[model samples]
Target: MKKPDLISELNTAINQNIIIEKNIKEIIDMSFKIFKKLFDEFGLELEKLCDFKYSSYYSKHKNIDLDLAIVKYFPKKDVKYKEFLEKILDTLKNLPYGYKIRKEQNDGYIAISQETSSKIINYRFIFLVRKKTKTGYCDYYNRNGIWQEDYALELTKSFSLANKISNGTLYKVKSLLNYVLKDQFKYNYGCDAILITWFYEFFSRSLNKYLDNKYNKKEKELDFVNFTKIKNLKKWFKYNIDINNLYYFIFTKIGETNTYYYPELSFEPLELFEGITRYSVNTNTFFKLPLSYFSHIKVFDLRNYQDVRLIQEMGGEEYGYSKKAWSKARDEDKRYFVSPFIISGPFNYAMFKKWYVLTSNSLFKTLPVEIKKDLNSLRQRESMEFLNMTGHNWISSYYAKLKYLQPYFDKKYPLIKERDLKVLIRMITTMVDKTKQSDWLLENDN
Candidate 1:
C-alpha cells in the first residue's frame, strides 16, 4: 500500500487501457507523469489511506472492459477537505459537467454544487466502495453501476492514505513507509490507486457498455440521461440499499428515516429539492415547506374522511332546495340544514393570493386569550378543536378574546336577555387581572 506499490498496481491497470510498447518500468514512470498532469489539473489529493478494488480485471469478459471509480471519504470535522476538492475541480477543466464530487454528510449525500448534472452521467459516484469478492459482485451493481451494499463501514474503520494507493486494504506497516517518502507523494499515490479502481469498476462499465451498444450491438441504445432510465436507477438503488446503512458515522449521525417524522412515505423537505433540482440544477432552495403546511387534512386522514362518510354527513339537504339556493341564508330554521363547506375552484389564482394575505396575518393574531394566558403562565398553550372556522380565519383571535356571554345571558334573564356589550368588555379586563394574579401565585410554587 505504499506509494510505489500503488504505482505498481496502477501500472498493471494502465497497461490494459491503451497499447503500450514501453517496458513496465517506463510504463509506470510515464503513467505517474500522465497521472500527475491529470491529478494536478483536477485538484484531487488522496487521503493518507483508502480502499480500492478492480472488477473484471482477471475475467474473460472482453466486453466488460474497465470499470473504475474512486470514493474519497473525508473526516466529519475536516472542513478543509471541501476547499481542496474545489481546487482540484478548478484544475481539471475537461471533467464533464456530470463529473461530481459528492460530500456525504450525516444529513444526506450532497453533491458539490458544480456536480448536480454529473450524477446522471457518472452513475458510480453515488455508490460506496465495497471490497468486491466473488459473491459480493451483485451487491455492488444496480441499474446504473456498483453501489456500496454496506453503510456500516463508516462506523467501524479509519481509512488511511496507504489504503487509498493500494488496490486492496492497507495496514499500518505499509502506511508508515509511504509517509516517509514525500508525504504528499503518499496522497498523490493513493489518488492514482482510486482513479484506477474507479476506472476499472464503474467508469469502464459505463463507457464500454455505451460504446458497444451504440456502435456494435443491435439493441436500442439507452439515453443514459433519460428520465425513465434515471427513475429506474433511483428506484433500484432505493430497493437494494437498506435505510439503516450508515455512510459517514460522525457527520451523518442520523439516517434520513430515523430523523424523519414520517418514514413510511417520504414527505421530507429535501424531497422538494429533488423535484426542482432535476430541471434547474443550480437551485439551492427546496419546495417541501409549502406542500407539507398546505396538505389537506382529509387527504392526510384518508380512512376517516372517506367520500362515503362525507356524503352521509352532507345528505340532510332537502330535495326542494337547489345547491345554488343553499348558497344564501334562507329561513333561520334552515341554518341547520345548510352545509357550511365551500369548495374553491381550480385555478382560483385570485382566491389563493387573497388567502395568503389572510393566513399570514392570522398566525400572529389568532392566539386565544385563554391559550395565551396558559402559555404565558404555564409555558403551555391550550388546544382548539382544529376545525379552522376560528382556526383558519384571520382576526378570529380578536373575536375569541371577546369572550362569549351566551351562558350568562341565558342564566341572568329569561326574555329579551341580550347581555350588555359594555358589561362583557369590563368582565374581560377584570378576568385578565385576576388571571395575572393567579399566574404569579402559581409561579411562586416552584
Candidate 2:
C-alpha cells in the first residue's frame, strides 16, 4: 500500500466508532458505581470519562473482533487515605458475597465477590489505599515498613501466597482487568502519565511533522492525522515509556488493518512483568475475585483476543522448549536469549544427565569418538562458565547446555529436526516420558 493511501485508511479507521460488547454494560456499571462511590467518600475528584468505544480490525486469517473499554479519570488529591479505606471497606464488605481484604504495600485492598448466579459469574472489589500522613512523607510501609511501588507490591503479594488459581487463568483475568483499570484510572492517578506526557510533547513540538500531506484527503477533512504516523508515535513515546513487544500484541490485534505493523504502546501491565513470574494469593478470597470476573463475562471468545505468538514471546526464548532462529538471533546485539546457556556448554549435559547416561552406556557403542569427545569437552567448559556466572545454576541453564549437544545428536542422530532437538531437551529435563517424546527425535532410527 502507498504511504498516502495507508495514511488515509488509518485516518478513517481511527475515527470509526467500533461497538463495545453488549454484556460489558454490566461490568461498566459495576466499575462506575464503585468509582463514583469511592470518589465521593474518599474526596478523589473526577476529571474525564470515556464510554467504551471500538474500531474495525482484520486478523491475519481475516477474522473480526470487537474491542471495547471505558475510562474514568480523576484529579490528584490529598487522598486522606486511612480514614478513606475504612469507609471503602465498609461499602464493599456489605455487598452480598462478603469481602476479602489483603494488605498491599502500606495500603489495604478489599476484594469482594458476588456468588455465581444465572446472571453474574461474580464481582470483585479491589482497592489500593496508600496512607498519606499530614507530613509529606510516603514510602511502602504497612504495619511494618512494607511498601513498594504498586507493581512491586502486587508482585510481592502474588508470590507470598498459596491458592489453586492456575497461572493461565490468573494471567488472562489480570490482563483484562489491567486494561480496564489502566484506561479508567490512567488519567485519574498516574496510571498513564508517561504516555499522555509523551503524546502532548510530541504534538506540541513537532505538530507539523505529524500532520504531513498524507492527512489531506478529499473524503474526510479530519483535523486528526493518520494512525500510520502511530508508528513514529510509538518510537517517540518509548523515550518516556518502556513497554515490551510481547504485550504490544493487544494494540496490534486491536488495530489490525495490516498483518505487519506492531505498535509498542505504553498501556499494558503484563509487559511490566515477565511470564516466569507467577501470581499467588494467600487466601482463596483474592484468587476468587479475578476468577469470578472472567467467568461471568463469557460473551466473547477470550481466545480470539489472545495471541499464541504473544504467549511464546512472553515466555521468553525457552518457552515451549522450541529453538529456531536462535543462533543468529542470540548475541550482545539482540540479547533475546534468556541466558548464555544457548551459547554455553555445561548446562547441556545437566539437562540430559539421564539421557547422557543412556548415551554413554547404550549409544556410545554406536556413536563416533569425535562427537563424544567434543560433547564432553564442551560440557566441562560451559559448566564452569555457568558456575562462574552464578554461584549455582538453576534448571533453565540446562537449555543452553542442550543446544551445544545438538551437533552430536545431529551427526549421530541425523534424523531429528533442530526444532525437535530443543523440545527433546526440555522434555528430558522436565522428566517427561521418553516414550512419548521418542517421536520428537530420530524418527527414522527404528
Candidate 3:
C-alpha cells in the first residue's frame, strides 16, 4: 500500500505537543538541513567531479525524527580530528535548543586525545519540545507548556573517519567521502533509494526491538532471581569461600510468584532516554544496563529486613541450648536471612571493588590469591557502553551513580512525580549503605 504524502501533516506535527505518524516526513525533510550544512563544509573537494558514489547521506538519515542521524566527517589533508570534533561541537552551540558537553567525559587538561583512530561516539543534546515553554525544564515549566520527553536527546553514533581503516562490517564506502568525489570517487549508492521504501515497511519500528527479543530481556524484568543462582556459591563449602556478604531473602506477595533478592521492590527505577530507540517512548524499556550486571547493589526492603532481623537475633540465642527456639527462628527468618556461609580463606575485597560498584569493601582484604588475581585481570580499563547508553562517573558510591540519574529520569518520564523519584533515590542510597554495613562479611570472615 502506498503511504500518503504527509509533508504538510508533518509540518503540523512538528509544531504540536504530541507527535504523530503524519509528522515524520516533515521531520526527515528538516533533518536534511543538517546534511546539507555538512556537505557544504566537506563537498568542496568533490566540486570538480560530477558526483560521488559513496556517502553517508545515502545510508544514514532520520529514523523517526532528527532523533537519529549520522554525523560523519573526514577532514581535508593536514586537518586534525581535534579541530574537526571541536568545530562540529561549536556548530551545535548555534542551535535554538540547549547543547552541553558532559563534564566528566572531556574537560580540564582533556587527557583523552581526539586524534585516536575512528571513534564512534553517541552524543546527546536537548531541544525545546513545546513552543509555549519560557524556560529550560530544570528551572520551571509553565502550566500551558510541555516538554517533549521523547525527542529531548538526539542520538548520534559516529563511525570510523580514518581512511583505509574499516572495522567489523564497515566498508571502504563507509569512510567519509573526501578525494575522488566528483570524477574518481566510488558511486555505489546501492540501497540509497530504497530507504524510504524500507522505512515504510520495516524501520518505522526501531531495530533495537528485534535485537532485544533474542537476548536476556533486560535481566531486571524478572522480579528476583533465586538466591542460589549467583556465580560462586556452590564452591563455598568445598573451597572455604566467604559468602557472608550475600544477603538472602525471598520477596513474595500472596498468590504472586515473583522471587526477590531484596525486601524492597525497586531501588534504581528504569527510565527511557531520547536518542536510544523509538519505542522507548512507548515502553519502560529504558536503562540499557541489566540489573544482573549492576554491581554494588543494596537491598531496599528495609522494613522486612528489620522484622526478619529481630526474629533472627531472638532465635539464634538458643541455637545450641534450645532446638525448639532455633527451629522457630529459622522459620521466621526464612524470607529474610542474612547470608550464613562463613569463608575462612583470604577473601578478595580489593578486586571486587575494582570491578564492581559494591558498597562493602570488607571482603576485599581477605579474598584468596587466585580470586584476587581474577578480579584484577578483569579490571576492564576501558569504558563499558552498549546500546548507545553510557554510565555516569560523577558519583562516589555504586548506588550514588543511580541516584545521580534522577534528573534525567524525571525528564524522560514526566508522569513519574519528581518528589517521589527523589525520595526513592535517597531511600535506596541509605538502605544500600546500611546493607553494606550489616553484610560486612568480615564479622565472620574467619
| Candidate maximizing TM-score | 2
In Å, residue 36's CA in model 2 sits off its true spot by: 2.2
CA lDDT, every model vs. true structure: 0.26, 0.26, 0.23
Q: 1-446 in candidate 2: lDDT tens per residue?
A: 53232222222322331223445445545644664565566454322111111111111121111111111123255334465556555544543333233333232333233222222222222233344434222223122233232222222122111001121212222222232222211111111122122222222223222222222222223322342244443443333222222123222232122111011222221111112112222111110000000000001111223423432343222111112222322321221211110000011111112222332244234435554454356454433332222211211222222222223223235433333333443443233222232222332221
User: Tens digit of lDDT per residue, candidate 3, span 1-446?
Assistant: 86332222222322231122334433434433543464356431111100111222221212111112112322223233345345545554453332223421121111111111222222222111222222222111111122112210110001111111111112122221211111111211111111111111121111122223422243223222332232322221113311111100100121121122212111123332222222212222232221110011111111356544544443221111222322433554322122211101111111112223321132233445554454434431211121111212111122222122233223334422433433443443344335532232223211
- Candidate 3: where is the Cα deviation over 4 Å? 1-20, 32-35, 42-79, 97-446
The RMSD of every model to the true structure, in order and in angstroms, is 31.8, 21.1, 27.7
Per-residue alpha-carbon lDDT of candidate 1 for residues 41-133, written as tens digits (9 for 90 to 100): 443322111211211111111111111222333323422434543544454454445334544332122232221211121111222223444
TM-score preference between candidates 2 and 3, better one: 2
Rank list by lDDT: 1, 2, 3
At residue 275, what lDDT does model 3 achieve? 28
Report how far residue 61 has shifted in candidate 2, in Å: 20
lDDT score at residue 10, model 1, on the 0-100 scale:
28
RMSD of 1: 31.8
